[model samples]
Target chain A: MTAAVPNAFDDPAYRQGVVELLGLLAYGEISAWERLAEDAKMAPTLAQEAEVAAMASAEWEHFAQLRDRLFALGEDPYAAMLPFQPIFQRFHARTQPEDFLEGLLKAYVGDGLAADFYREIAAFLDAETRELVLDTLSGTGHSEFVVDVIRDAIAEEPRVGGKLALWGRRFMGEALSQAQTVVAERDALTAVLVGNADRPGAVMDLTVIGRMLTRLTEAHTERMDKLGLAA
Target chain B: MTAAVPNAFDDPAYRQGVVELLGLLAYGEISAWERLAEDAKMAPTLAQEAEVAAMASAEWEHFAQLRDRLFALGEDPYAAMLPFQPIFQRFHARTQPEDFLEGLLKAYVGDGLAADFYREIAAFLDAETRELVLDTLSGTGHSEFVVDVIRDAIAEEPRVGGKLALWGRRFMGEALSQAQTVVAERDALTAVLVGNADRPGAVMDLTVIGRMLTRLTEAHTERMDKLGLAA
Candidate 1:
């Protein structure tokens, strides 16, 4: 390995952007942890409850790692994470699942979107920070578990699919609205994301961000489709 | 090391007892995880919330290890964990924390008692099972965290200490009631605990059980004292 500081470190604004992006992603994991822990309560069986709670616990480990990295970067992890909390709170408030299956869908669908967005943002960061961001967003293998349960339930009752499809659409709408609110408020994240229009090395633009959103939407739809729900 | 099977394996009843004990301990951890995860919602700060959630996650790791070991022993881990759910549900319902401090107290005081009891029970099993039980019962380093917050809160308002002391006593009473109920219901556990009064190698008697409870109470008092609360 070459003993060279990554290009991202050559610019202070880019460093700030990396920290802001990580803080936002870190808060996303923390909120996900809280939501899944709440969801565990509505699980129909102890074994199933353990499965859901296991996912929630995995989020905590990710959050701890992300928070530590944020601290290492000379940021107060909690303060850095503060701006994103209300965005999640608003999204969760609007999208509270009516039952256990809906909760699983949200856990699966919601995390899928967040993870995809974070993975995209990782591209603008230095190698180490990029790896840390990716590490924090890795799913806890609960995707299959969530899919199995939701698909089995939907198969057993075809009418339930219509109700969940509508719910999925509502979840997607709420998430995007809240995400736009976060992007509006967190200028550092916005800058790190699309970069300056005149910056020679800028890889992100309105076009790139638009394509990223499209990719994220495609992934979310795939997740919902796997659960036998329409996006 | 000798490949000794240990004395507990000589008797099928004792082996059943080991399984029973491990099952009970595993369920205790699983329940603790659920309760603490639920408790995380009441934390005043996100940092404190993560602290509580981290403890809950540690419990899941312990439960996973125990569950895998139970499967290795040709037992259905969930079935083994089933008998203790209602036991915990009853205790939690009776002692739901009214606020964040109360939740912290429950997390601390409740876990202290459970850990102490399990540590005592660890002595009666084969080496492997004994170690597994002990490992699961290890505290997630929450003692200092809980004590620091509770003591600080109480210091801010002296009257809060009195209220929490009463709550601690209530918690202790409810725990003992449920524990006796468990002792009454789980015959395999009972047989393993007291070692059959007529058996020549009987390791426990009414006297030993009495002493165990006494020691458990003393430990609980010390925990309460550490928090500057009355037992």
Candidate 2:
């Protein structure tokens, strides 16, 4: 008979949960790397390809860092990631970018939520692992690219504002939907953010979550306005 | 009325051919980054993701270097790259990898041929361009992955020999077919490798090309055999 897999909801779950989450994140980074790298082909200039390629490399580095943390936790990173494959795959399928701008917006909005989620979880981790996740989140290139492309597109064609603004909205909606699914399906993962013994405010309710999301939305809107996409 | 677009194959063509080639190469590198990064998700451990992510990152760096070289030549890198989009997109459609191993093998064999082609073209370029191309070709991570995966797979499953060996054959056949198409359709690109100034024994001909193919085939065969797939 096959052995039943250990549930990570317990302290026994620590090793498995750490490994699995890291694997999932590593895979996410990997997919992001490939998307950005390949999309660089759509770039109109050699210089642009270089810029996108560099950005894609940052995703790969993030994957590496997460993988390293998984290793430190004694997780078999690939096995840990295997369970969530369909989930991540479905999310990507539902949100496939149609063009260069869509691609950039996907990265920008998608990584923003990812960073927020990781920040929440990092507080549950030991110092070293938390530091690694923090550093990885800090290294995001999506915002820079998003700001540059939106500004350029607006500067070149003021008519792009209506289309891109709508596209940005769709991107955010899809990303938030996937994040909610992730949180709902994984209670232990939620515990990483909400069950901390040391801090009373470590866990937040729906109102606080809504406020955070609102702030992010406001920032994104401001960025769009700065790029003349929200005139 | 729109001005006549310059034919790239014409003598004294205004389009910068070298930069165009670099754009294509840089795009390929970015695509490689994406493929490898995504494939790393199939890994069974975090360490494996790290290994694959590092490989993906290397592809990005290669694209960066090629992009810089193109910029130095005073061409608008994007404009140079625009002509070959359809062809590249078609190649990608026809040759999508089915799995992690397939993706890695694609990188290994496909990029190896591309590196050889780049080296041949480098020989035809002036001193600076030659050095730049050579430097870009030197740091490929594809072969190392190929060797590692093939070796490990063979060690783990002695019976996987036939499937993988057959897959290797398909890889080479598809690659060579696409290469021929590239050579036939891209005349100036052919000129880049065939040499602007002919020298006896400097440029490769059909016989020399055949010999090189034979070598790569032999190496691939040896790899398959090492993985216990020779039967």
Candidate 3:
């Protein structure tokens, strides 16, 4: 089905959707970088701070890639990123971590959920766009760092796990709420996921989106469990 | 003199000084990254925020290089970075910018001053270590970005030049004060500047140190002039 249309950019609706998706992802990277850098401040040691700073740097690199892609498409990269700023600002403001542990959980669980959702959306995109989207979503290889820190924290103070589990749930809830708002407000991006009528071979019915959400949920659950937190 | 220090690393005093210098630099990079990221939040536009973030990422990259070099020298990178953390913390705390423009100027003027000081010291080191130190001190190619923004800002509001010029002086003063503290507290690093008797080729007299400080001040004055601020 994906092979049926080699030039998805030919469809205006598809182009708009792709641009919206790229912008959303680009802004998401910037927001991630900001949040991770903020979290680095709460790190207990210089080594841990450097670890988190490294993650923030990785996010900046991803943002650069997406921004360049938008520029190559002749879209003003900052203008492309503008529409989603308020949404991200609100998400971060509402989910301000109370402590270092909550911040770590948010980075791991929140980012994991967002990446899964974006990857799901990427599947409906043109091959070139899909590849770019997936590549950007490929996280900074610091998940194990986050996991180890969280697990060690929990092992030392058994009660800390419960608080983190709750924080994980809050992150998921905030993220999903924001995701719904994005879907409701961004018609072009929604069309990317639900399939635009004018964009042939891009048609995925409601069932597909439902299954996609389910997969995203299951993946989030798996990640939470890995961190010894209940989803 | 440079050719005579082929095995400078074998000298215990040289090694201690080298390690101390690297630690100072590594922490400085981390501190720079933190301050730049903080400044990014005050950016009026997303593009400007990204410009600042890019600078922060560049610092992180340099930090990685210094950290890896420390590791190769069999020093614990975090321990190497620890001694200078409080000094940087105080420097940043005292020079917190009041607004976006102040932030930009601080980053430009402050970093420029710090780089010049370090580069002057780098010249007295072993060739290989000197090269690494100098390479890390190279300004991220975003000076033009900072210069352009500040010039346009001053052009738009003539009064801004006066305020930023004062800010520039304050940055230089604060940096010098903290730097003096670093030199007084860190005997090994000071030893690097005032060569040890055992480290023959590394011997730099107090006269050279005085000239180095003069060169640093002259460079700072030139940078302020470039930014249309009185030194």
| Model 3 alpha-carbon drift over 4 Å, by segment | A1-6, A195-205, B1-6, B194-204
Docking class of 2: acceptable
lDDT of each: 0.81, 0.64, 0.85
Off by over 4 Å in 1: A1-7, A195-204, B1-10, B195-204
Candidate 3 C-alpha error for residue A11, in Å: 1.3
Give the worst 10-residue stretch by lDDT in candidate 2 chain A. Answer: A192-201
Tens-digit lDDT string for candidate 3 (A59-166): 999999999999999999999889999999999998899998888888888678767876777667777887887888786778889999999999999999999888
TM-score of chain B of each: 0.92, 0.76, 0.91
Write candidate 2's Cα lDDT for A108-133 as tens digits: 66676677767767766756667888
What is the docking quality class of candidate 1? medium
lDDT winner between candidates 2 and 3: 3
Q: Is candidate 2 or candidate 3 better by DockQ?
A: 3
Which of the predicted structures, 1 or 3, would earn the higher DockQ when compared with the native?
A: 3
lDDT string for model 1 (B120-195, tens) is 8766566787788788778577789999998998999999999999999999999888878877787667766654
Where is model 3 chain A poorest over a 10-residue stretch in terms of lDDT?
A: A197-206
| Tens-digit lDDT string for candidate 2 (B101-177) | 66666666666666666765676676666787888887775466577876687678766556666766776676567
